[model samples]
Target: MNVLLFGASGMIGQGVLRECLLDDRVESVVAVVRKPLGFTHPKLREVVHEDFTDFSSLAGEFKAVDACFFCLGISSARKSEEEYRRITYDYTLAAARALPSNPSLTFTYVSGEGTDSTESGRSMWARVKGRTENDLLAMPFHAYMFRPGYIQPLHGATSRTRAYRLLYVGVSWLYPLLRRVIPKHVTTTENLGRAMLAVAGAGGAGEHILYSPEINRLAAEGR
Candidate 1:
């Protein structure tokens, strides 16, 4: 399976990329990045894109992919709702539009847990993610939205927030204990990444794959 990835430089993206690289089923990986990925592999191709809002120039590159894992995300630091929506909505739509050319495209989006697409106007981040999720679900291609909570990294912390870093370190040893008590809503970055790869290689049964505990359970069995 040929996979296209966006935001291959971010925390979750890095983990997902690693999983894709290791998987034998993945024939090739095309990364669309703002900066050069500086890696040489027979199955890897880096497409340096200048603008995220427009992919017209890179249409050909986006056309032949079997599946796409869009991990491009920004933190809700101090940005206003408009700025956040632009990044989360506008950018996602632009990239998703290219999937039509590859009719059997499976789109796996990295979405948060609290997202609500009813336009409830509650939390700005959730509302935005909800809207994005709603829109993507309406698209023609197959779509899967992963809503993971407290993603424990496979390696060192990558978040700039000191609180997140400390939490990662603290939970590094207690993950097994927490998994027994906590619901499967909380998952490791490794598991989530592998799940995405599985969905991409094996076409999801329906138009949308809303990954919850059951989906993760199935993914674990295959691994």
Candidate 2:
């Protein structure tokens, strides 16, 4: 299967990209990024794109793509709602629109756990993500939304954001305990990637929105 990946440099994206490369089922991976990934893989292809709002020039890259892992996202910490919406809603929709209108194609978007599908929520990021999810589901392709919480970065995968990195480092020692105590709400980057592949391979069947428990189940089933 040919896979199209976005946000390949991010923490979650890195894990997903690693799994795609390791899995023999995946033939090739095309990663869209603003800068080079600085590494080479036999099955990996990097496409540098500066403008996230427009993906018209990358239309050819989506051709014959069986699955697309849209992991692009940003923290809404201090940014205004407008800035967050631009990256959260606008960029995601642009990519979804750019893909071929093939019903067989699987498009998995990485959203957080508390994302509001109502599109009217107290949280700005959740509202924008909710709208993005709603719009993508309405598209022709087979789409699924992933809502993972407390993802443990495995195999050296680290977040690009400094605050996240620090948090992960501080919490790394407690992840095992957390996992045992709250298995349903916790998952690893490895499992997340595997789950995405599993859903895509299943032709986007089952639940449209997956949480950590469901994600882990899918990963195990895929294995």
Best by lDDT: 2
Q: Model 1: runs farther than 4 Å from truth?
A: 155-157, 160-163, 206-212
Give Cα-based local distance difference scores for all models.
Answer: 0.78, 0.93
Tens-digit lDDT track for model 2 on 49-168? 999999999899889799999998999999999999999899999998998878999999999899999988798889988999999999998899999989999999999999999999
Per-residue alpha-carbon lDDT of model 1 for 15-128, expressed as tens digits?
778788888989889999988866777888999888888888887787678889998998767889999999998999899986645446889999887788687967889899
lDDT of 1 at 56: 85
Q: List the residue pairs that clash in candidate 2.
A: none
TM-score for each of the candidates: 0.90, 0.98
Query: Which pairs of residues collide in candidate 1?
Result: none
Tell how far residue 109 is off in model 1, in angstroms: 0.5
In model 2, what is the error at residue 203, expressed in angstroms?
A: 1.5
The per-residue C-alpha lDDT of model 1 at residue 194 equals 82
| lDDT at 86, model 1 | 90
